[model samples]
Target: MDGRPSFLIGGGQAADAIARIDWAATPLGPIGQWPQSLKTALSMMLLSSFPKAIAWGRELTTFHNDAFAPILGDKPQALGRPFSEVWVEVWPEIQPMVEKAFAGEATFIENFKLTIDRHGYPEEAYFTFCYSPIRAENGEVGGMMDTVMETTETVLAQRQLAVTNAELSHRMRNALAMVGAIATMSLRHATGLDEARRQLSQRLAALGRTQSFLSGEAAEDAHIYELIEQSFSAHPNLRQRIDVVGADFRLGSNQALALSLALNELITNSIKYGALSKPEGRIGIRWDCAGFRFVWREAGISGVEAPSREGFGSKVLMQFVPASFSGQARMRYESDGLIYELEAPAAAIDNT
Candidate 1:
């Protein structure tokens, strides 16, 4: 012995492991025989707060610090093992980088993916790290030092946010197009400028209500009964005049929007001229199935007749809304009242 105290005398757990290593049985030989350059590098790595490790000599004996131990996970024995064995799970992916470092070319990778067997099972991980050559006294690259930081959480969060932003942009474009269509149709059907303005404003407000409901974080598929109830929430007395009966089911986002718009048109017409135009009139709405089959019935009104010309409300209820779901709609204007029926596949309304 050189009669010197151990190099790791007051170091942390990783340093203590290195001190207990049987250096004489290893390719690196005894600590007393270690080169001054290797000793200096090890001393610096042992004191680092950042996760770091040194792979020394031709054998690439692994040595790391307390901060780096958790990175090894279940493989605590990695402290004195060969670097190749300690990280065998990702050797194929990292071998080229390690070889480059050994050749005196430093390598830096960000958000690098590796499937590692670190927690007693294989799991994917992302990292940002650098591998730089460690030189000997003769100025030759004899080993490599790794400084690493895990970036898995940060990378995943950014990716998720990007997806959400893309979806929102698409929805916004669709909404603007719908608004343009509603304005054009409303103006064409109005008898005068004031009538056009009033009709446009009412339709826009209806669109706004539907959007508000869908914008909620907890909003997913909407319940059929809840959607109908929401449409009449503004008119408490109207609730008593409306009879809703059917097995309730959820409507997908697009389906909910279409149905809400159609109902708004129907309700508006009824309150102005149809069944709900008189105190004695009443309305009944019913639906069923995964693919909804709906019926709207109005009664207690007399001299009901089909309009001479189809307007925006007629096209929305009898054509556009039905076509959107690849379904069919029918309307009958009997002398007693107007009855509307729509049939579409449940798949059209299933948001999930």
Candidate 2:
């Protein structure tokens, strides 16, 4: 090399490395012998703040700027190496693009996918880049220059956003369908206009309350204990009268909504006629972890009887609530008080 060639003067580490390396040992022989085209291309590439690389001469010798180092990651030394061999893992996917550049065709692509193994493990990556031909003094295509920027994180983020939007749309439709069903059942089961108006208003209010208390994953997961607390929020006076017995455990969005609604119905009935109506009456809610059983037991009431006709509240407690967790429910009305029991696998209520 002639002391410090003019074309190798300004670029940081890349310039230093290119000037310091013994070019006589590489395929291009010596730096003094390098074509003006290669020298000019290297000078411009090395000076750029953006990531850039050039594959010059017959060997397709690689030369890159300091900004391009991170893209190589923990790969083998790439400076002064053949571009194709330097990225052999992804060469099969990118070779055609390289060929296009050398054939005097410049190509610009966005978010191009390439699976590479630069850090000892295969990973999918994306990049937006332009590969343009470099011309020799004779006007022949001498090599190619790559101007690139990795877009892996941006691409993945966009895909995740799409998925989240789709899930929100699906959840919204399901909630609307549930609201429609609740309205229909509430109006159908009412014995009188006054009862229908009260029932519909209360049921809708309970549904709104369910949305307020649930927390965690996708805004739908919650503890069984929390569901109970929220259900009893409207009846602070009766809360002390009722006894809660259960292990606190998380339930999915569906289970949380169903259980809270069921508990709300039970509370409404109790306030109007069952345990909460009489001062001495008491209520107990027990959920066993060993076998997965949720039992609601009432005590200290008389003349409790099955409803003359099924209501939306009954359907929620006896059918929809248990069915949400892939289980069965039974409701019993003895002369003393009402009883509701539901059984299902723990897995059914926990899976998100």
Candidate 3:
């Protein structure tokens, strides 16, 4: 061995350590005497980045770092153990899967849920795993390989978003119903036939605007202040007598329409019997959302009482509104004026 090291330069301890070393008994002596290229190729194949394992015959198997160890759980009696012994709990299910993979075929599982006592504790895990046959020199399947990826987070997020959206839709529908009722009722009590027709037209126009905003057909979201202003815009005489106080917030189509109609009725009622009836009377409107409840209340109507008959506006507000959006509305007669309130969930406000 001259001055050079006794070990071959290219076949040093470090190089051998990095390569896949197999000690299986083959027909041609031990497997180590296979051609140098064949041995190197096999080493590279096993040591590749892919999570890989070779399941030999019906029991024993070996796998690489990126694949085997991470999924082994806490069984110290795992490596070199029979496949059935290592995965006893799932062997019933894994048996058929492994058999199919070894029959020279590949199988894929998408979005599969699995629970196991992998680390000595039971936990649910979701994984997409695949089984493929590992081929021999003559292209015959000699063993099987396994591969996987996790999708638990993505699945959970999607479910949560869906639930929230459904809640929102229900709320929005109720709000729209409330608005429609108010508009219709207000038109019913106009001073004369001509006045009633004119009020109906105006209310219809306001309803259209509310609908457009909630449906996203409008370029901008419907701000509560803007909606209040629009509702009052139709009544210049009562405009100065009204005050709207609240932080600006957006409403979906259903919510916008509900508020729009409700405001229309409140303002109209004030004009006919509340503060608008008295030159010095003033109407105050306020609203906000807390704990998922949307609250709207109006004050400053004087000596009000529930009408003996159900008017067009009352029907729309009482029946249509609640059924449409799944919400409730109440009107109370106070000496100073009328107070009306609506309550529902935030989801009714998300048109999206």
Candidate 4:
């Protein structure tokens, strides 16, 4: 080591470390013997806040600033090591870029993915950076300088947003298809334009309400009672005449939508001609866990008889709604009233 003080003209920890380094013991011999191009690049890197590194000579010995230290993570001894040895994990991916720079061709890459072991554990990362060649006094390529910035967080956020957008688009398409099916079936059972329009509007409104419920934070599953209550909210007067009793079970979004629409149809029919047609009329709904059995019984209407033909409402209760959950449904008209029963597997209501 020389007795004269090393002249380091920068204000950072990296600059101070450079001043104290035993350059005589390294491959480059001593700081006084360093080429002008290497000295100038090292000065700029030590003074800047950005992460930068220099790989000089045939050995590609590494020299980096304090700002680049954290990027090396657990490998603190990498400061004076060869670039290839320090970053061996990603050497294969970056070798081509380094070769291009050595050939006097500068290169830039954005959001380049690399699997690195900076934290002792291997993990994927992203970076945007440029590699430029440095020339010696004789005009020969002597080394490469790299200015790099990590972009892992930004890249991951963009990927997550894309997935969320795709899911929302798929849900919208399914909802629109369900609305079309409801409109077609309702119109088929109507005797007049006015009746058809009324049925279609009511069914769509019920569908909209269910969709709104699922849009909330706890959207994955909803209680069976909450779904049934939402169907009757618009007809507050009929709520008093309906009795719902069962152990509350959670249903997935699709199951909730189908069941809500079925309940709306049942209530609408009762209001028009069944138990709800009379002041004293009432409907009882009950369910149990065994096979997910559900029963709906109506009482207090006179002259009750099974319809000679099936209507949209009857089909919804006896066919469509139950089929949505892979279940079976049965309907009967006794001398006194109407009865509907359904049985479904628990998995059918909860699985996607």
> Which candidate comes out best when scored by TM-score?
2
Sort the candidates on lDDT, descending order.
Answer: 2, 1, 4, 3
Best by lDDT: 2
Q: Tens digits of per-residue lDDT for model 3 on 1-352? A: 3232222224333224324233343232334443343343335444555444445544444333334456665765343445666667777877788888878778899777767677878777666778777766666666666676666677677788898678566645754664465455656566677877777776677676566555554333477777777777777777776676667777655556666776665666666766677777777777665522434343554466666766666655666666545677776666666666666666655545
2 against 3, candidate with superior lDDT: 2
Give the alpha-carbon lDDT of every model.
0.85, 0.86, 0.60, 0.84
Local accuracy of candidate 4 as per-residue lDDT tens digits, 15-68: 777767898999998888888878877888877899999888888989888888
Q: Which stretches of candidate 2 lie over 4 Å from their true place?
A: 1-3, 191-198, 212-220, 233-238, 278-280, 300-305, 345-347, 350-352
lDDT of 2 by residue, 46-73 (tens): 8899999998877889999999999989
Worst 10 residues of 3 by lDDT: 1-10
Ranking by TM-score: 2, 1, 4, 3
Worst 10-residue stretch by lDDT in candidate 4?
Answer: 2-11
Task: Output the lDDT of residue 14, model 1.
Answer: 76
Model 2 residue pairs with clashes = none
Clashing pairs in 1: 252-349, 290-346, 291-345, 291-346
> In candidate 3, residue 186 scores what lDDT?
59
Candidate 1 lDDT at 31 equals 84
Q: Which of 1 and 3 is ahead in lDDT?
A: 1
